[model samples]
Target: MAFSGITTKFTRSLVIKMAAILKDRCLRRIFKKIDFVRKPLRLNFVTDNGQHSIDKLLVANRGEIACRVMETAKKLGIRTVAVFSDVDEQSKHVKMADEAYHIGPALARESYLKMDKIIDVAKRSQAQAIHPGYGFLSEKPEFAELCFKENVIFVGPPSSAIRDMGIKSTSKKIMSDAGVPIIKGYHGNDQSNERLKAEAEKIGYPIMLKAVRGGGGKGMRIVWKAEDFDDALESARRESLKSFNDDIMLVEKFVESPRHVEVQVFGDTFGNTVYLFERDCSVQRRHQKIIEEAPAPGISSEVRRKLGEAAVKAAKAVGYTGAGTVEFIMDKTHDFYFMEMNTRLQVEHPVTEMITGVDLVEWQLRIAAGERLPLLQSEIILNGYSFEARIYAEDPDNDFLPGAGPLVSLTTPLPSRLVRIETGVVQGDDVSVHYDPMIAKLVVWSKDRSSALRLLTHSLRQYNIVGLSTNLDFLINLSNHQEFRNGNVNTDFIQDYYNDLFPEKKSLSPDLLARASVYLILLEKRKQRKSFDDIISPWNLSSCFRVNSDLSRKISLNDGYSDVEILLSFENDDSFKIQIGDNVMKGFGNLEINGSQKLLKVTIDGVVSKLNVVEHNNTIYCFSMEGNYKVHRLIPSFIKSKCEAMNLGDAIAPMTGTIVKVNINNGQTVKEGDIVMIMEAMKMEHVICAPKDGLVENVYYAVGDTVERNSVLISYLKEDEKN
Candidate 1:
């Protein structure tokens, strides 16, 4: 019986087999016309081959990865050419490169992914090699083919290898033929909806609809039941067409809580290959890896050997050369299956490098220069554990929505023996909505997985980034998770336990509060000194009230969700020591006494911190490393009684976005759940809906206008009045 008006899996499989027969025949014919003869080459870096020296290299991508490639090329005495879209002329990558060329408009399709323009720029610039970083045209076989035709070395795997692995259906067939275990699925070309439905039915409920030609989880859907097949199929097709220009999809059985593992492989022209072991990329959101690590924890040595062997077989099947990754889906049973092969360098290649002391990019360049594999498989060693956390310009609390704007403040702690940060952005750089939201990558290395995790967590907490929202807190929590620390992770681990990962806590402890107060005071003192101002007027002196000629005030703090409250007293302008409930915290520091200027140097548990106090109206604003806190000087009891409520009807735009679709009209009656407007920011659409049934009192702006954070969209009348 047919499901969702789609054909049966058996029929779809036959159609796929038939399509493969035809496609293979066509590919064989095409391959016959292409010459695979090795060219006579002279020694380059090893010997003085001046005529064959590569004068310039063109980077055929954008963003952090492009900048990274340019840095390596520049250090190697090569002139670097950066190709950019109209919107990226002033980008960091463009500024860092030796020369810049405008390819087209901002959209990737019109620029970075446009092979012809990229090739044209290379030819014009007289570049001897083209490096397709990680994304964009990195995996496209045609770009590599063009580079080969023009005699420009493609700093990646051979074009033939890319072609063989580019198509999912064909790649699966090749891997399966090569004896690699593949996940049960139908990798066929029966685009008929009916046929797809049948394949899904065979795969059983909870199947995945995956695009045959794309990564980054684009054009992918997980249908839990047969009834949801048609809608999912359409959605997957639409996304696939938009992302990869290919609507052909395959159905595979969904493995619940499967860990994502991949083995890094490198091959040389001398027919030698070595596996760099495995990296666990299971911590993901929306199928994009957020954290990755090498030498997957909790995995057995026997399993590692099996995975490595499988990856090598998959690579050898396509005659793979240069840097490539063989990804796999491992279930709880420890049974692994081939996912796909990435025929280019991975973004997380640094973690592998940290552990193995191997520079994969340098090896890529050397291999491209006709060098033999420096290390054999037996020589490859799995070293200590390493972890990488991808720092992105996105809001974790807001469903991890992408954030865009000028980076007002960006600072990372210096790299040490255990911590490393690879970033391409600088202060004042604008994070545009047109590209990926990643800002940098923070990597840490240690002798063991537990130690590596601990080091990474500490580094994240020490990192300070202002302006745009980030996943720093979430990452820290994830690193400390028991499951993650124990290395018992899978692709679904985050989704299944996200709520527990980010817990809602209220109010700081008395010691922490004391520390925060001191830190704020110090910060204010520094600012005042910088401004060379004394006795700053309008500073809230009432917040620090005097009792019996002593400049000290009693303050009450409460846990918002509970009735628990704690009282503590602080001196406004005196060095004081206090013992509260077995905790001895002291406020002692050099004080520049001035009217209305209250500063304190406090030591909590032997660690000194500062605090600054400023008064506005009757409220005191305290700024510290903990966060901003406001307290009333007149009514100290009110501090623990009620916290200020976040105002509603104050529709704040999620990010620095443009109003793309304005659906509400002024004075129009709308019910709750109605979408009033939609904003486009960071390449994603955000829908603003009415919070309750009410009449729209006003429309704030029109379409095509840019909006900042906290910008009001529309106001709604009271729910009772609307009814």
Candidate 2:
């Protein structure tokens, strides 16, 4: 201090170290006395000039959303760190990250939802920011506050915003005060069952019981009658606790013909907020959107402007920043109401990005860095229509029962400038039951709605997944449905067209039989050729020389219930004659190979078709326009007898899951269709019911116990056999 101009290097270093030490100690003391979750602890660790630059980021989630965020971060020249559970070590996200840290076991609560573990990983990886993807700790105010305490940027809104918008009652009151049309509901402090029942009755039957703290259909149930109120509330509470750690709920009037329309809004620290137009997520199943499109199809220009303006108002009211969606429910007449604001990016944000020609994730990163809004509301332009079909590993025909296993064969539509494929698994990766069943999202864009729908359906058909049942075919049907094509969609769209969507199976086509027969016969000869080891190949592969007839064999295919005999005759090396019953047809088939693609091109009579054929688990999967089919051949009696058979009167778990509730007790009489057990799998519940009237002979599983698929949960004695 006495001779600043003549200061030595040792003295300069000593002074700088003391300043840093004192700053750290002073900040810690101040933070300790503050309630981080309820206050603005937003501090810039990298810069103080209001704009921050991040060199590395940690993704605090898994699966497709995690991968989605990393892709954008990488594009921005930012290195990414991935935190994965044990099961996700081999996940696509882990493989794509610059560094990956194993957090915990397969369960999300023990891994992704553990704030301390994620924050620790970020610190260990030297990440400057944490991007909590759409789920997990994304909406938790505490997680955001924790990031604040650590001086790491949480790429989301402030904790105050998350708290204000996360609770339904708080958000409703805020929106109502802001002149946003709010739906009538009970948002009170009373938590007793009697109080909730009274509130629901006041709201009328068909009331919606929703978790106050979370979104995405978790802890949401519809009580259609007074008798169902208690059960629905309990179910909502259980799911709420598992997903959000909050069981507080609010009552709301269930809207009919409710069209789910949401507008994407973005903001920055500079107080600039804008709407990126709206997406129509009206077509949904299981209270979650399966397909989403933008901009919404039929709203008038005036209504569209109002919708966007209202969304901006909602975002601005909370001093929001980063990517957020303001969801609204609209009636048939286009009258809209505020639903809730998602405190993070939505699963359907791709539709918004497609139409806006902007990378929302990149926007989120820039905003978190204290940068100004990328584009103003007036500067933003709506480009075209886009649709996102969420491909899931679930049985669509089985009430959308979720399944888990290795994706023995997985292929997606080739990504292009106009088409995007968001996924986190590969051909050999397993889709564990510990996470969501969504396998990938197929996003397609076009200049108009009709063109986009066509592209969406075309892409859906191109997606071929084997080893497990999927919603690929169901998505195809949904995209091509007349009502959907006409933009006549609502939350009840799936229920309204159930019959058309899940129709009774039509008789197998002779054309398909002819093509399948040719492929099989050729496959057999190829195997025979392989056995010769390229020595006696021609003789064994060639048709047996015949004087007056061709070699024939009866190819019988049994689809579990019915049997169809296909008389296959080898006409030549590649040509075949397949006759079913009295109908006969000629076809030729060949396997065309290009890179990793295998296309089975076949001609039946004068018609030609190409099918994606995959052989997995002894089943030939044929995926085509008609639908996905499992080709099965009759097993020998001895082989069938060797397989273990399940008891006739036993109710079994539909998939590998934990038994959450066992409704049946030993020796207890129950009627047919009564729920025997409830299992939780793939983040949802499924009920196992009695097949007929019977007395429970034994209880095979109990609550909180995990069971494999087809494991008997309850063994029943038939009514006639009960003593």
User: Which numbered prediction scores highest in lDDT against the true structure?
Assistant: 2
Kindly report which residue stretches of model 1 are placed more than 4 angstroms away from their true locations once superposed: 1-52, 86-91, 510-516, 519-586, 589-601, 604-607, 610-653, 656-690, 693-723
Lowest-sum lDDT 10-residue window in model 2 = 34-43
lDDT per residue as tens, model 2, 449-530: 9999999988888788887878888888888899889999999999999988887876667676666666677677666776
Model 1 vs. true fold: TM: 0.77
Looking at model 2, residue 587 earns an lDDT score of 80
Q: What is the clash count for each candidate, in the order shown?
A: 15, 0
Off by over 4 Å in 2: 1-52, 533-538, 545-550, 593-597, 625-627, 637-647, 718-723
lDDT string, candidate 1, 1-723, tens digits: 445434576678889999997775565444323311122323242223233446578888888888878776665567899998987888888998999999999778888889989889988999878889987899888888887776778889878889778778889899989999998899887789999999888879889888888688777888999898996887677667766788999889999889999999999877888798999999898778999999887889999999998898888887888999999999888889999899999999989888876667767766777778656676566668999999998888778888876665565767875787777677768777778888889999988888888888877765655556678778878888888888888888878778878777665466755543444444444565566555544243323434553444334333233332223345444344544456656654543435544444566656765545445444444434444444443455454343332345535687777786788888898888887887766544567777777678888989888888667788766567666
